[model samples]
Target: MLGDGSLGNVGSPPRVGCVAGVFDLFHVGHVDVLERARRHSDRLVVAVLSDEWAMDAWGARPFVPLLERAQIVEHLRCVDEVVAVDDVRPEWLTGVLGVQTVFAASATDGVLGVDELDGIPPGLITVLPAGRGSRSPILRAAIDQRQSRSSVA
Candidate 1:
């Protein structure tokens, strides 16, 4: 929302895009999706999920706290705005933030569930292909392995 270099013309809403994630590890895969989201719209808002919500949805707490996680995403060069949210509903951005597009990691496995995205305007969503080794599950495994080896020593 800062620069005027990319804002849409007057009388039309700005071309805003939104992406949400737990961002526990803040790995390159997170970067990949945000980069893609940036491409889909003029302004990109990255919403980092709160620790409580992450635990409720995924059954495990994020290794990183919500404020720290949001700070991590805020530093990304591709992101225009960053918010920490307890809810991951796409409508929050579309209905309140004037976001015109929402970038998801995939049709089946993005930050949002299919039900949350229901009723979204057609063609307003972009699903990026996820690459291996960048997902939280993979990073979490690595952390688990390192901790296990250290504990055994």
Candidate 2:
């Protein structure tokens, strides 16, 4: 996602916090993560990765386009800012946004190490509880089940 603050109204910054993701398919699990991020700070910045960035990082294009995905996040009341983050190293993003805290799902792996975490400059790292059925395998199973039913119909 590009780091341009375009989601919420410009105010006094408001102890900004953040959560970043590919946000493919705009699932309920994504909403839960954003909502949880909002609770930790007055202003929540949801970083939606760009298509090029997603392909580079994840080896595939995202299910949703960057503009549409960003709009979804921008419209949410819980989100105070929406930015495009394209960093290979995300810890730098926390420092750029002046975030007070950074939230991620408990299921997340490969997050910044202690040294990388310290480089955040201002944000405190926090992990939220992993929501039920939020994992890729579980979500894929649910989607497959729905698709199978539709095919039968």
Candidate 3:
């Protein structure tokens, strides 16, 4: 922690929001959440799950590596800073990162459940509505179809 009791952000905005996710496939849903998150804060910090964290949490490695995923998220207009994280802790976000709000994709969908926001105040935890679709199932189906076609051929 910096002298300010949080990460060093010399000129950061007063309201900084954070969004943490695997962001493996970089799908439309991811963009929607980030755009929505940006609206609630002056600056948005996106925490891309590290490959090790992804495997440990979801039991599978991300198709896109950590650096590539971070790069993709880093270029998004809605995101101000992209950091790779091994875990998502509410205390760390609020106490260590100077984050005023933590934006989550959904409350029940395991992105950031209500129970997980223990340290952050209820008002500071924003559970945005779920996006249209996710990448995991879609990508899995596509891969399965390709494998079937190859096997048939």
Highest TM-score scorer: 1
Q: What TM-score, over all chains together, does every model reach?
A: 0.76, 0.65, 0.75
Question: Candidate 3: lDDT over CA atoms?
Answer: 0.74
Return the lDDT, model 2, position 101: 68
Candidates by lDDT, descending order: 3, 1, 2
Q: Model 2: what TM-score? A: 0.65
Model 3 off-target regions past 4 Å? 1-13, 107-123, 134-136, 144-153
lDDT of 1 by residue, 1-153 (tens): 423456666666668888877877777767777776676677889878788877887788888888888888899888989988887565677777778777666422336633455566657776666643445666678998998899999
> Which digits, one per residue and each the tens of the lDDT, describe model 3 over residues 1-153?
222234345575457888888787677777777887787777789888789987876677877789999999899987789888888777778787888888876622324545544556787788877765566566856976997899999
Give the CA lDDT, 0 to 100, for residue 99 in model 1. Answer: 81
Q: Give Cα-based local distance difference scores for all models.
A: 0.72, 0.64, 0.74
- Write one digit per residue (lDDT tens) for candidate 2, span 38-98: 7667777776767887687667676678888888778987787888766424455555777
Ranking by TM-score: 1, 3, 2
Off by over 4 Å in 2: 1-13, 88-95, 106-123, 134-153
Model 3 lowest lDDT segment of ten: 1-10
